[model samples]
Every structure is written in C-alpha cells, then in structure tokens.
Target: MISGILAYRNIQNSILNGVKIPHSTSQPLIFGENGKYYLAVFVFFFSREDIEKGLVERPTMWAVADIETGKIIEIRQTKNKEFSDASYKIKYNVRADAQYDTSKKYYEKAFAILDSCRNEIINTDRFNPEEYKHYLDMIVANIPKEYQRFYFDLSV
Candidate 1:
C-alpha cells in the first residue's frame, strides 16, 4: 500500500509512444515478471476540473516487473473519482509534468530533483522515499541497456 506523488504534468508531458498511464502500466510491471523482487507504485493527485474531462488525476498505478527474475517489484494503482457527498467536485489536475520519457534530459533532470527533493517528496505526500528507492533499484535492473539513462542512483 505504498503511494507516490508525481505532478499532474509529468505523465501529461511524457514523450513515449502511447505511454498513457493505464495503458503503459502492464509493460513496466511485466518486466518484473521474470525477476527476484517485485514492486508496485501507485501515484495519486486530486483535481476538480479534471473530473469534467474524464481524467485519472487521483490515482496512477505503476507496477514494476523484472523480466529476468519473474518478479513484480512494484505496483501503482490510480483512482480518480468523486468524493461522495462532498460539495466541491471541481479540482484542477496536477498542473503538468516537467519532462518527457523519450528524452535523456528528462531523466537527468528528474534525477536532480530526486536528489534534492527528498524532504519535499515526504512533505508532499507523493512518496515514501525509503520504500520507493529500494524498489526503484529492483525495477531499474530490468531496464534495457539503452533506457538505462532513465534510471540512476539517487542516494542522498
């Protein structure tokens, strides 16, 4: 039951082909199918206006799959729905993601953020740093060679 906070923009600004949250979920998680350790990541954001447009701003699930070890190291489940009985239903989806998956710069920039933003992450309720970092290493071990740039060591 580990949850993360990814700005509403990160996914929206992604460059991967058809890398939509719900759609691309299986690919990442499937990689863990052959691994030793499994990880599941769930990101949640709240927005009032996004509801009118039918968006998943509340919960974003990202499960990790290690192809060689047959393990699902992580899981992320997204849930975006109305708070029943609540009067306020209009919330803005996370403003936007600052980077795109298709670019190396994106990963580098993200790495910088991860290195400097540990405290911010905890304060933002976007992650449980201790848990996610350990799982991230397990997830990265399965990444293809070319994509390795997207994975980095963020030890603070």
Candidate 2:
C-alpha cells in the first residue's frame, strides 16, 4: 500500500519536473505478480547532458515493473511522431508549469523500488502493442481473482 502510493507520487513529481509521466489519467497503474499488487508510474526521460554523460540517451518508451514477480512491462511507446518537437514542446510546457506536491522522501523511495526491480524489465528497442498484450495477457491470467477488479480498471 505504502510503496504503491509512493511510486505514484514520484511519477507525479516527474510530471511537475518537466517530464511526462507517460500514462493516462483515466487509470491507476496496476499489476499482479508473485502474490502481490503493484501500481507503476513512469519516471522522466534522461536529459541531453545525462545522455551524453552515458546515463541514458534516446529514451522513447516507459515501464512499470512488478517487483515481486520480476515482471517489468513497458507501459507505452513514444513514437517519433508522438514526441515530435511540436508535441514535446506541448508536453514540456505542461510538465514545467505543473505543480509537484510529492516529498523528497517519496521520490527516493520510488527510485529504490524501481532500481531493485530493474532486473525484471526485459529491454527492447521498440514498442509493439501486440507484443505488450501477449505479455499482459500472460501476466493478467496469472493474477489471482481478488485483483481482477484493479486490472479491469487498468486495461485499455
């Protein structure tokens, strides 16, 4: 419960910090794995400097990993069109002006959780909805009945 909220709050911070959270507002990030429920929130993309410094470059996707089950799913794909200069400018404006209310501690905690679960996320260069759905179906089928309601809300 606590960690889930923390993750959401951290993503909210990213939005306020001039970065898109990368998911929709109509849903609560949801997953069931290893007998647990996880709510994911997308963090920001690496800056040009950070990219040049070898931290990260050319990030065009997002992820929400199930820490317990070691299943990390890329939540969305940002096509070149989706992030074109014009679109980026729009998102950037929103992010820059958005108010961030989460605390420092929340960001740290969310980072820790994501880092710990990093290994679970299988890397790929592109975002394919069909492929994501195959994985999503597999994971969804494995979730216990009690969590079905949550998944229903999260399904696109």
* Candidate 1 lDDT over residue span 20-132, tens digit each: 43322211211122222232222334344443454433223343433222234334432342212212344323223333243555444443433333334435534445554
Question: Against the correct fold, how does model 2 do in TM-score?
Answer: 0.27
lDDT per residue as tens, model 2, 23-79: 322112444434444544333455556434433323244445453332444455556
- Candidate 1's TM-score: 0.25
TM-score of each: 0.25, 0.27
Candidate 1's displacement at residue 83, Å, is 18
Query: What local distance difference test score does each model get?
Result: 0.33, 0.38
